[model samples]
Structure formats: C-alpha cells, structure tokens
Target: MVQPANKRLVTEAAIETRLTTERLVTEAAIETRLTTDAASRWGAAWASGSTSRLREFFAANTGPRVAITGAPIVGTVTVASQADASALVGKEVQGGVYINTPDLELRDFRIKGDGRYALIDFGPFASRTYIHHIEFDGQQSKDTNAGLGVSSGTGPSDLRVEWNNFHDLNDAAHTRPGSSYKYNFVHDPLVWNTAAWGAYNPAIHPHTDGFQWLRGSGEVVSRNFIEVPYKSVSATPNTNSCLIIKTDVAAIDNVTITENYLNGGTRTVMVNDGGFGLPTNISFDKNRFGPDFNDGIWQYSNASSMVFGSNTWAQTKQVVPTTNGSLGYRSAQPALDPDPLGFGCVMTNLGYGAAATWGAANDARYVRALSGGLINGIEFHVTVSSGNVSVGVYRGRGRGLTHMPYDLVATSGTVACPAAGAARIAIPETWVEPGDYLAMSCDNVTMQLLLFSGTAAPLFRPLGAATAASHPLPASAPSPASPGFRMPILVGTFV
Candidate 1:
C-alpha cells in the first residue's frame, strides 16, 4: 500500500523554481488533488465529475489533449495531435473518469476524444492496471476491442480492464483489441467495420459485439451486463455475446472470468470461430446467461486448460440439463472476497466428477452429483501431465491428517483434451466443507474451488456419461478456494 507521508510537494511555484517541468508522479497526483483518476492507482475506483459549461470544461485541460487530464475531462477530450494509437508507446496514463468536469458539468455522459485513440504501451504491463466507471460512448475502436488499448511495443504481458462501459463505437475495423472483457453494455451494439466502403453512418451501421477478445488476448471478465447487438440491413456485423474469447493456447493463459450476466442475442455467449480453442489456464465462474442463444459456454478447438464454475442459465435451445451444473458453463459466486486462509487443505464437502473416457465400465458407473448443493460448486486445482489425469479426492473431517476420509468422493479423471481428441468430465458438486484453508494446489500452481449448495433447486446432479474423450466441464468461477460462494442447496428442490 502506498501510504501518504508528511513530506509533501511545497506548491507548484516552489517546485517550478527548482525543476524544469512538473512531471506529476503517479503517487503525488492523489495527494495534490491534481490527478482525478488517482483512485485507480491504489486499486480503487476511477472518478470524473460533470459540469454545465461543456466547452469551457474541455478547453481548459492539459496532457494527452486539452480536455481530459487533471480532473475528469468531460465535454470533449481528445488528443492534441491526431497520430497513430501506437504513438502512446511509453506515455504513462492516469485512470479514466466518467463524471463531469468543472467546465462541462455534463450529466450522465462520457464522450471519447476525437481522432485515433492512444495505447498505453506499458511494456509487458508487469503492474496491474484498470479502467473503471468510465464510458467511451463516442470513441472509435482503433484496435481489437475498443477506443483505448494496452499493447506493448515488444513484450506481451497481462492487464486488467474492469467496471468500465463502452457504447456506440464509431468504427469497427479488425483493428480493435479483440481480447478484452466486454461486460459493459453497448447501447448501439454494432457499427460494422465497413470503413472501406466509405459510406458509414451510425444510424445505418449494423450492430455487433458488446465485449469481445479475439486471438492474442488474455484477461478476466466479470460483473458485466452484456446484450446482443442489432443486425445491419446489408450486413450482420455483431452477434450476442458479453464475451467472444477466441481460443488459442499460445495467445492467452490464466484468464479468470466470473460474476457476469449475458442475454438477448443470436448467440448469448461464447461465440468462437474455433481458430484455436479457449486460451489455457482460464476459469469461468458465477454468471447468469439467458435465452435466445444457441450454445451455452462452448468451444471447438483443442485449446487446453479451461474450467467452468457455478452460473445460472435459462436457455431456449437445450434447457441446459440440470446435471449441467458440473458440465456446461455457469449454472453462480462468492459475493465478498473471503478473508485469507492459512496453508492447508480445507476440505469440507465433496463434488462429484466423472470420466467416461476411462471406458464404459466407469463411464455410466458413477452419479453426476454434489453431496452439498449447487451453490456449493467446489473447485480444486491440480497439475496434470498433458495426458489423461485422474484427480484423487481425499476429504477429511477438519484438517487433521487422520480424519481424511478414505475416498469420501469418487476419484475424478480429467477428460484431458489432447491434440487429437478431447473428453468430457463431470464437475465436482459438494466436496468442500465451506472453510478457509492455508493453501491448496493440485499439481503445482495454486488452485481454488467452490462446492456450492444449490439455491434455486435441489443439488442438480446428473448421472449419465459417454466417452469422456472430447467434452470438458463448464466454466468454473475463479478463486476456486475463496469463500462466500455458496449454492445452499435446498432439500425441498429434491422432491
């Protein structure tokens, strides 16, 4: 934590007398009230205010452009020079705000700067950064996903984009950053990339994706409300998806997705060309998806390492079987971040997973069930060699070694998606005991789990299986180990 100190900057006049320029530091801006988006620095919410005098507000601004620095730049914020977005290679940017400035005093509106947007080529972005509560209503997607993007000049690392909303993107060439969390609502969902035709207007432009991350993108998505975009008269630019994450193991890894609601589209969620498959080390948890869609959290390619967690669904195509709790994506989450736990296995309940690929003898042998409930969708992470891996479930009464139940839950074998074929495995339902642990890891990397207690219905446990050769479990929420995610399966739903 960056603590505020007694030592302070002695006014700009005092500093100007000594230094050449007031290169406002990321830390100092918060103390001096000069930087409006300072809250973002400390993992806090970014802020911006509105004003009545829209022009005056935008005219009297500094940095990047005239109307977007210091405080929340409303009215009209843009770049002083219309150059390529890549030009912002090394320029450091503070947080973005969604409020009115002293001048603009505008209400409930955030406008993007004109011309090409900038990219904070924060090399590899070792540090965690965020863009929240702001709106890029008038911006044009210069890259894959939206107006502003973070692409390093050389190294490619991980970055976080959250809580922000984008709508009415002007242009939609393939240039947009295809890999991002499009949980935000795009009022004018699609404005196709027909820029080549030279006959484009917002009114006639077809609607498309809300938030989509194509190949070469790896980031977590949660707490977003996504809707399907409108169809264009001449073209169908957008499909319905809160997220369109192209699956390519080489491009993305360790992406955590949770707590989002997507609905109303030709395809409600997970629209993939199967260029590769889902990125590796990705987890989907606690999201609510509704009707008017074809598939529920699906991918075709053999991208490895993906987990789907507790999510709710109201589908029109297949009614997502009750047993899908452990099969398809979602079907739900910890509301608050559980306080840290010590280092040990805090096994309380047990969730049932199945592997039919092991052959029909074991395929239809076990039941697809969770002893706890749906909300108790437990998670356990382990490392497995790129082959058929079986997870040994060792449940115990508390943490005592002797108390470890002898095979309380059936051992689960992953349907390991090899280059040739993939397999299906039932997700564990009730395996955790709902308590914090010191630390948990299966193979080597730290793993998390959620064995929820079904809230809406009885612990929806399905007991059927086929060759676990190509099908994998649904989107498991992130932090499989954290507390607060409880399905609280009601006994009444059983009848």
Candidate 2:
C-alpha cells in the first residue's frame, strides 16, 4: 500500500512540471511578437527619410542611442582622447563639444549649444575627422557670443562633414582648407541686432553666413541646401550671405563650390579678395540661386582663375552672368570723398537760364572703360536733389583723347530723384570697348554731384547749348572751350 501511494505522488508532480513549461513557452512567444512589431515600426520610420520622423524616433529611443532633448548641452565637454571620442558615438551632447582627437568618427548624434560653436575640432592638421548623421541645433539662443554649428581651431584640419542638419546658428560652418562639406541642410540662421551684440562694428555686424571659408585651400563644398532667408522673423536684412569665401586668415586656393541650392541672404554668395590677394582656382558651378535675396545673386571682388558656370536663378531659369561686374570710382575711393564742395550741375531741361551753361551737356562726365563690356545701369551719389531726371549714356568718338566728342548710346526713362543719398537708374544695354569713354547726361533736374577737384589733364565735358531732348543727346557733342574743373562721381553696372 505504501509503494502505490508514492507512485501516485510522482505522477502528479510530473503533470505539474509539464503545465509550468507550457506557460513559460506561451509568454516567450508573446514577447517575441511585441519586439517584432516594434522593430517593424522603427524600420518604416527610418525608411521614410523624413527629418521630423527621424527626430521623433531619436527623441523616444533609449538605451544605446541618445535622444535629442532640444536643450543646451550642460557644459563644455571635451572629447580629448581616442577613448572619449569613441564613447561620444551614438550620444546626444548639450553645450559645446571640443574634439582634440585624431581619426575620430562621430555619428548618430545631436548637439545643442549656446556657445561659440556646437562642435569645434582642435585636432591636428591631418587628423581626418569625420562627422556625419548629426543634428546641430542652436536653439535660437539669445547669447550674443553664440556662433557656428561646426568650426575648427587655428589649424586647417582635414574634416569631412556630411549628412547633417544645422540650424539656428550664427553660421552653419566655418571651415579651413582640406575640408569637404556635402549632403547637409543648413537653414534658418540666428538673427541678432548688431548694436546689441557689440562684437563687430554695428554697420557690418551680424555677418551671418551659410558656409564661410575664411582661409586655406583644397576644400569642396557641394550638394548642400543652404538658405539664409533675406529677412529674419523680425523682417530685417540681418542675414549676410549663403556662402562667403574669404582669405581673412590666409590665402585660399583650389576651392570648389558646386551643385548647391542657395537662397536668400542680403547677397547669396560673396567671394572677397580679403586684401590677402585673389583666391586662386575658385570654382562655382551648377548652383541654383533662389530669388529671395535682398541685394543680388552673388558679388565677387578681385577673384582670379574663378570658374562660374551654369549657375541659374531658380524661378526664371536664367543663367547668372559670370561677367556681371560693377564699374565706378567707388571701387577706387573706398573712403568717403575728401573734397566736400559739390559740383552744382543742372540738368538740360531744368530752367537754369544763364546758369544753363553748367547744364547737362556741360556737366556731363565720362567714365573711361578699363576693359570692354556692356553697361546695364548707372548709379550716382546725389548731394542736392531736385525733380525727375532722365539719365543717358554716350559713346566716345576718339580713344585716348581728353576732350573728345560723344554719341548718344542709350538712355533711361524719367527717374525720380531721391530725397538724399545714392540713386540707381537702369538704361538699355549698351556696348563699350577698352579706352572708350562712357559719359552720362541728365535732364529736367538740378542736383549737386560729387566732385574730384584739381584733377590734372581732366577729361573735360564739351560745352553746348541745352539740347531740346536730353536723350539722344546731340548726335555729336560740341568741343570744350576749357578743361573741366571737376570730376563728377558716376558709376555703371556692367557685364
């Protein structure tokens, strides 16, 4: 009877063990299904390639991946050693991240800062640092010193910055030579009052830029969407340019800027000589410029060996002229006019009576062409203003002559005089050659022109009676009785 009871107990124990094993298996299956569904959702979100969705995923994810919190990185974090750099991967950093390591690869991260730079690399010149798959958010910090999204130290480190989003910063990046920037979206730069931020002279302050290359060479900036809106949210031309290639620190050479979608800013692109001399081998090609700029498409000063080709306006699809250049005495006289005496020159049709001797024809001043090009418009500094005036350009009859005759070429319709300051008048395109004199005439107004007094062997304006019409100025201007006393300030936009 004892043996039979022991067998019954063993059988019941075996049945209980089987039931526990089945329950454990069912729970494991349910956990696997939940994990698979979560992974599928994550895959779909990533495949969408939407920035907002990706940001959302990063915000919600935990464990190995750091999420973007939209808050400033706590303090200055230094990734000085190789181990530190390796640990920085897949992390979200607040405040500034200073990198001083070599061959460091920083990926899958977000950096928010209120400092001079979100990420600054002080690595060796040939460190070959790679930064990608990152978001740099400036958070629109009102800190006056807040600066670029990414920047390098004094050395021109070899950096590859790609596949990143940069916004709300003073500038997207300020790179030196041997840097390549591609597949980046840079927009909505931070705007600040120049006066409030007393760093730069208030006049030229808030010099925001998309990609600024202060110096160095062998840099390639391609396939980037850089937009510096013409007006800030406060509706001001606070943004400066999309790209600025300047040799502020040292000379730059062999820089290529191509296939960029650049829009807005006061001027979309600015290539300055930087007083260090012209940047060599600067290439800008196949870039689309948006029409949202406040000033012009691009302005380059003294660039040598520059290749500007296939650049077009996005809306009109018109090719941006490579030869679009400015001509005038302003380039020569960068400072204010030293002589304050105004040349009280009256327009031809203005009732000057006896004073008509100093009228349009007599007051005409010629700008000698340094090189051959077409004049599209005229800009002049106005001292005293009067009524509406018609501006006209005339072609010189003789080369290398002081008091040569001129033939009317093109003239603008009636242009109203501004209260005071400079004015621009657009005229029909007219051609001119080297050594040719481009003279200007105005009708039906009285204004004081900027004067260059005591100019030797002056190019005198020919004295003539007031022609009935200011435009189509007399077929041949009369010869001058005396050498001109003053040189009037007038410049033309040429191409």
Q: Which candidate is the best by lDDT?
A: 2
lDDT of 2 by residue, 210-273 (tens): 9987788899997666767654223244677898888787888999988777876676778887
Candidate 2 residue-wise lDDT at 10: 88
| lDDT value for model 2 | 0.58
lDDT of each: 0.32, 0.58
Q: Which stretches of candidate 1 lie over 4 Å from their true place?
A: 1-109, 113-129, 139-158, 170-187, 191-207, 214-218, 229-237, 247-250, 271-278, 292-297, 302-305, 314-495
Writing each residue's lDDT as its tens digit, candidate 1 over 1-495 gives: 433442344455477865643453633464346334422331221111111111112222211222232444333233222132223222323332221111111112234533333222233222333323344443444233334322222333333343344454432111112234432433334344565436555454433545544445446565445544222122343444445555433355556666555553444444344555455655677655543232343432343444666655422112222222123222222211111242122223344422112221111111122222222222333222233333322222212221112112222344442232222233333222222111111221112122233222233222211122211211111211112211211110100
Query: What's the C-alpha lDDT at position 76 in model 2?
Result: 73
- After the best TM-score superposition of candidate 2, give how far the Cα of residue 78 lies from its true spot, in angstroms: 1.4
